[model samples]
Target: MPIYKTIAHNSQTSVKIWKITESYEDLLKPLDLKPKNLTRVLGMKSELHQRGFLSIRHLLREFGYTDQDLFYDGNGKPHLKDGKHISITHSFTFSAVVVSEDFVGIDIEKQRDKIAVIAHKFVDYELDYLNKIAENYVNDLTKIWCVKESLYKMFATNGLSFKEHCLVIPFAKKEESTVAWIDYKDKKFRYNAQFLEFEGFTCAYTLPS
Candidate 1:
């Protein structure tokens, strides 16, 4: 499928999602991948990962970018040659990319019960409001995870702990947006978080507030 959804969050930032329904070959044929990216994709052992990687490149195309226009820093954060901020994520059968003139981060997660088992590792302040027995427990955890993951990507810094450094302000399941913070190095950074759910997957992204 081509661009399952596109969110024009504003004039300066946009999010694009791709549902990976095509074969690896079909995805590869149209992308003019950088040689290193081609090698990396070919080196991937899982077909699922290869498809996810290719699908992200397709998402870039939708944003008027090519593989040659993208690069990564020492921290492994993606950047565009034109100086725009970019974040990319893919899981299972879905992939997404967010690009903006300012810093931004995005993440998509497959809702799963297993996340509950390790929630303590990445969840902190959120525990105050989370009820493990609630019907939306797993889904809420997924949303929190996605939000923190985006914050992690946005910072692109080493030694950042999700539980210690990030917080997702309380939000009901029905709300599409929320507030979040990163309290690191004795300073705080704030972001406006937006999220959506479809096909048992939850996606969240953050932009500077």
Candidate 2:
């Protein structure tokens, strides 16, 4: 499908999402990265992950960046030589990137009923708020999952628990514009979180302050 979307909040920060529609081998030719690396680390056996990475690289190109401009920190966070903070995410057939002059993070997830089963592992105070909503709102649950995932990516650490550390205010069903915050290590970071439905997946991006 080669579907792509970009959101420029301002010149300092922007987000891009791409859906792969090309062959995996053809997609990896430009970057020349080892396909095995993604397969080994992400378990991306199908062509989805390969094309997703290609889409990510293409998005970087839109910003005048290339794979050479990309590097990873000790914590595995992608960094650009110009000192702009970056976060990358891929789920199934989609990949996303967010960049900013300051710290930033972005995450995309496939909305599924399975998230509800695992909600306890990453949802806490948010649960109480979610419970107040009617039981038939599956879309609401998906938004909560995306919000927490975005928060977790923003934190980008192992010790933080989404259930205990992340909190998202309830929004109307299928709401795409909302604000949320995360409290980590006694530091409170606020974010603007919004959701978009793309090919049965829910993508969320968080702008950190």
Candidate 3:
């Protein structure tokens, strides 16, 4: 029940983050989950993952939704039974959901120095402004990863490369918002992105621009 933060992005879109501090049993005790989802959670080997999954259901309830109202398509993108857009994400100690009236996506990632080691895999244009020696290098990389990840969730398709297809416009970390583009299959899509940091984690969410 620890909803760490909530962002009313606008009248039609909202973001909710939950800090996972409860045992899996305690988190599951108050809700009813669909059989398949229940099986999915129970089958997870990591207690952390199970708790994250259950805590998401709690978040859905906050948005007036139940587990039964959620489903995924063949693309593995989550959908609401009533036709709202939904995106979900979770890291080691946190989980979040973003629901909107338009195409939307969300992601949460823990800030870690190791992200620097893997930055080459998903970084391209942003490198023009990134300084590897800067004090906030890891923090910036983490935000870029979260933005690209949110783009991936919104454009749930095969063959989209984070480094090659997604581009984030330059912006200072203090700005907390930017524009991102997905150039795939010879077509371009635009989204407005916003992000924040809490407890050493970064959470980013996007909506079609």
Candidate 4:
């Protein structure tokens, strides 16, 4: 489906999303990949996952990057050779990448009631305002998960617990953005979070503040 959306959040950050409707073979034929990436894709068990991986390469192409230009650190955080921070995510049929001069993170998730059952795993302070019985429960849960996941990607540090260390400030369902903070080990960092919903999926991203 090509690039489903592009976000120019500011002069320094941009994000691109791809709806992966192409077959694995269709996606594989058009590109050149580093041998490791080819091996990585071939090692994957699901064609859906393979397509998602390939589609992210295409998303990189949209920004004038190639597989060789991207690499992961020991912690699996992605970085571009040109020194930009990059975050990647793929779920179900959608994949997205965010590149920015400042630290940034992005996540996409399919909305489902299944997330509610596991809310206690990654949710804490957020429960203060969440109404488990309301129609917004699933959407709300998904957004908070995405927010934590995005922060996890940007911070890319181990031992940061979503339930204990992250705090998502109260936000109504219709608002486009909010403030969040990470208070871990006496080092505090804050972020500006933004979100959107479409086709039963919720996407959230965070930029360092």
Best by lDDT: 1
- Point out the higher-scoring one by lDDT: 2 or 4: 4
Error of 2 at 22 (Å): 0.5
For model 3, how does the per-residue alpha-carbon lDDT over 63-172 read when each residue is reduced to its tens digit? Answer: 99999999999999999999999999999989999999999999999999999999999999999999899899999999999999999999999999999999999888
Clashes of each: 0, 0, 0, 0
Ranking by lDDT: 1, 3, 4, 2
- TM-scores of the models, in the given order? 0.99, 0.85, 0.98, 0.98
List, residue by residue over 69-114, the lDDT tens digit for candidate 1. Answer: 9999999999999999999999999999999999999999999999
lDDT string, candidate 2, 1-209, tens digits:
44388888789988888777767766766664445554452466656665676777777877779877888777677899888888888888788888889677677777676767776776677666675346634556677777777777667788877777777877776467788887888998788887788787877777764
Tell me the alpha-carbon RMSD of every candidate: 0.6, 2.9, 0.8, 0.7
The true-versus-predicted C-alpha distance at residue 26 of model 4, in Å, is: 0.9
Write out the backbone clash pairs for model 3.
none
* lDDT for 167 (candidate 1): 97
TM-score of candidate 2 versus the correct structure, residues matched by position: 0.85
> Over the full model, what C-alpha lDDT does candidate 1 score relative to the true structure?
0.96
Candidate 4, overall lDDT? 0.92
State candidate 3's TM-score. Answer: 0.98
